[model samples]
Target: MLTLPGYLVHIRKRGGYRKRFGTRFGRGMDIPVKRAGARRIWIQAVSLGEMLAIEPLLKALASDERIEIYLTVTTSTGYALALEKYSELAVGISYFPIDFYPFSSRVWDRIEPDIAICAETELWPEHTHQAVKRGIPFLLVNGRLSDRSFKRAMKLRGFFRTVLLNTAQVYACSELDRDRYVALGAPSERVVTTGNIKVDVAIEPVLDPVTCSSMRAEMGISDGFLLLGSSTWPGEEEMLIDAFRAVREHDDRARLMIVPRHAERRHEIEAMLRERASDLAFHFKSRGLPERELDILIADTHGELRALTQLADLAFIGKSLPPHTEGQTPVECGVLGKAMVFGSGMSNFRSIREGLLQYGAAREVSDEAEAIATILDLSQDPAKRGKMGEGGKAWHASCKGAVERTVKGVLSWLDR
Candidate 1:
């Protein structure tokens, strides 16, 4: 197959990424390097979550004197997080060269990796083809195939078949996902069911009532109020506005906490929330809030929401409430020791969320009325809420080690 001018394609890909996700994940920058040793392992993760999934592997490989891991990401956000979180293990963070022929060739020559591992379903044709052309064994680790994405991929069988075959080994997230890969032309022998690596998050229970109370107080949430948290994605705020209002009619004074997926969207979401709840004041806005009349408090920042789960009397995680994204966040309100409410549209994070629900840690509902009622029910019963939180923490702890398994896969490729 023919390709476009390498420089022009590179320029366009860079510009487009800058325009759409540049602010969120910066233009992938090629870091200036001075290393006498060559990278034996080139690990490419597109962004933050993908980058995160590979941390265990990097840690595991750091011990090998023969191996050098070169980490690369497509977004600035991923780069920043990698530098911040995995600086000790990641040898170098560079922009993944945009997939144009000669540019990719230049990248491969510069790094001169013996092996390359890409996380998830990111199968860039140019990159893999070059790796194959140069005889560098390539592997896809932690591959997932949601029914929706797999069906669409099957449509492009002609396009993806060669690329699939290029992968030396496939570490799928599940057996069902493995079958999906097999259908997509991945050799069954190369496919192995490696459980999803997201389960490796260090989710220890943090019991800081004083700090939790202060955060809630700063956000204008009074005692005995429900905290509905909307994590990442668009369109979730609108869903929760109606959801919260419905809860208020029954509870009189309900508190809502919204944390958008992107921190930059906070101002936009705050503007919308202010118009809807004109009387409410929030800490983010710095407006004087009545201790009692405050209904909704927008969490316009990051890093604290996961910890703030402890303050929710009864919680509703936002992304799941709306169809903006495929699945809901499964906010782990239960992780904070509370049976929080979710929506019927828990298409995202289905398996993990289902596990929480099966353990009686989370409960899902159809609409605002049902969600509100569930929160209120949990609020009225302390025993039930405490039990749910305990269950969630238990389940979260039980599911650790995704990172270890992923690390093993990355190391195994060194032999090939």
Candidate 2:
């Protein structure tokens, strides 16, 4: 009953809706029959970010011969990425069943996993309760609560307490996260600080310099200082475009790249580009490469941020500016050794932000004007940028090993 409205609204939308419609009702899931004598572990990642963050953990578990993996995602893009990236590693990849009534139970019965894991803050009551009822240990990996989420959870304190009670363990991203879980009624003994797996994802660059140079050439960006807007949300794009214009006035070689959080928002961003920065030559990744040289590139695609961030001289972590709280992950930028800037709303990654600032890897701005000024200043300072990049690499190195800790803990629990 609670999910009916969301279900109806989801189905009414376009793009992979019909294909995912059945999964919500615990039907049409592509989970394979469990292998005999194998320990099947069911892992649920809510979307693309969660899916990417959990990749290392997935690989670690897959290394064990006795373990079989069943991975489920709650978004179309996440399912698509799973098929593209983890089809071989994961025994089966499908949409997570709706976390309500028979839907959750039906899926649970079908998989009959020895252990159930939810990534980050995706602790659905019905899902956790289903695992508890079946005596299956439920785990929350890389768990965190943003400032906004903590406040909301306190409002529904009773409800969250019941959910936490069912969870066997929570692998938090930081000490603060551990405290937040404990305050919300999660048993302190069950909550452990495991750092963040996102650090693992950004430990090294996947693309080589030659490949990065070729990619830039393909985008018609030749030797220009690239300013990337990583995982931008609404309003961030406009601010970036304005900053880019200002940046270009100072440095003619400055290039802009905007990768919005949702690829579906491509058209919206395109329209905005036409309105705000009509004078600049821009190209969209969704469309083929431009015939002429381009000054701006819009990456309106999925699973390409890592590749794009590698090409950036300076990057902006989006969703941190005004009107949007709970910022996007800056771990990738920091780990990739890029000088970065973000707005004040980094409560989602509060610990990481503090670390990055402390290490001189990133700069935090108060608003759009300050962000623009900071970007402008950083654009011309090669030595400062280099130092910042080194700082980012240092900070990222210090934050590594969460995946290893999480894998060891999970396997030990399963053995017990």
Candidate 3:
């Protein structure tokens, strides 16, 4: 079954499959066995975003000489990022085993973790069962239960509650999340509201002034107003393009830089742009310097959004624009103090959105027309833009210390 075309393609593309699969059968392969008297910690994050959220915790844990860390990720991108970012700190990085009784038991035996931490919403019943049966502590850190997810979980409350009860504790991201988790079968006493770790994201801009200026020049926007559409999703790109067109109708010097959430969709996005409006000249960041006459810069590359956000005069976070999707994190824009706009579907980051609104840090638009109007208004009024930017910086600063609080909470559990 693993040799089928689609499965084979996935495994080959991800690489190191044999070694990773070996770990599922209690074989460590090249991974060093844990020291006899050392504490072993297994941390699992489901994807890139979850991995990013757990960075502060990882760094803190790495500093402790008595602890050994083993990190696992479910997705190919996440596994790649783990190796790139944490190879030195971690004992080993591997793909998470399939969450079946046999596979989970094999991995449990191999790692023999003193504790297991799952970032965000990555809950596997078999894994939890194995941990519970082995008497190893299992914790769900930075946990959240969105309304949509809560509704679905409620339908299987009996089973889900049993699985959740196996966890030693659940550190929820918000009070609402705590309540929802309780309603869905987690013991109220075992859950605590630790706030969202994402709010404490480290925002060190990768580009300095010289490099930023060079990048701007290369993208044909050294002197113009740059509006970044950061981490935009599929349908959100079209809405942004339309908004950019409207903005350019009045200010031709304005430029739109879109960094799509998925870089692999660059070709699809390019095709869509051509189909929607072929007259709009755009260049892909991966292809080299853009033409001097180009109006749009498609940052179709990975790990560049942070630097790009720093360059923008204003930004619009994606995923929110489409009614069905719950929006990407705007915390990066907030942290950078950028004047920003986002669509109505921001339930995933509801607390962050509300905080930004209370401080006048961001504007929420219900549709494309509203987004265009707000973007144009921000572009024209320097004073308004400056105020929004400052407000965002203040809001983001106020939201710090979640990481410290979360680390403290995790340590309490580990100590016990």
How do all models score by TM-score?
A: 0.81, 0.97, 0.92
Model 3 global lDDT (CA atoms, 0 to 1): 0.83
Model 3 RMSD vs true structure = 3.0
List the global CA lDDT of all models.
Answer: 0.68, 0.90, 0.83
Query: Per-residue lDDT tens digits of candidate 3, residues 188-269?
Result: 9999888888888886655677888887887777767888898888888888888788778888888889998877788899
Show where candidate 2 strays beyond 4 Å.
10-15, 202-205
Task: Give candidate 3's error at residue 126 in angstroms.
Answer: 0.9
Could you tell me which 10 consecutive residues in candidate 2 have the lowest summed lDDT?
Answer: 11-20
Please count the clashing residue pairs in each candidate, in the order shown.
Answer: 8, 0, 0
Against the true structure, candidate 2 has what lDDT?
Answer: 0.90
Ranking by TM-score: 2, 3, 1
Candidate 2 lDDT at 28 equals 78
Q: Which candidate number maximizes lDDT?
A: 2
* Predicted structure 2, TM vs. truth: 0.97
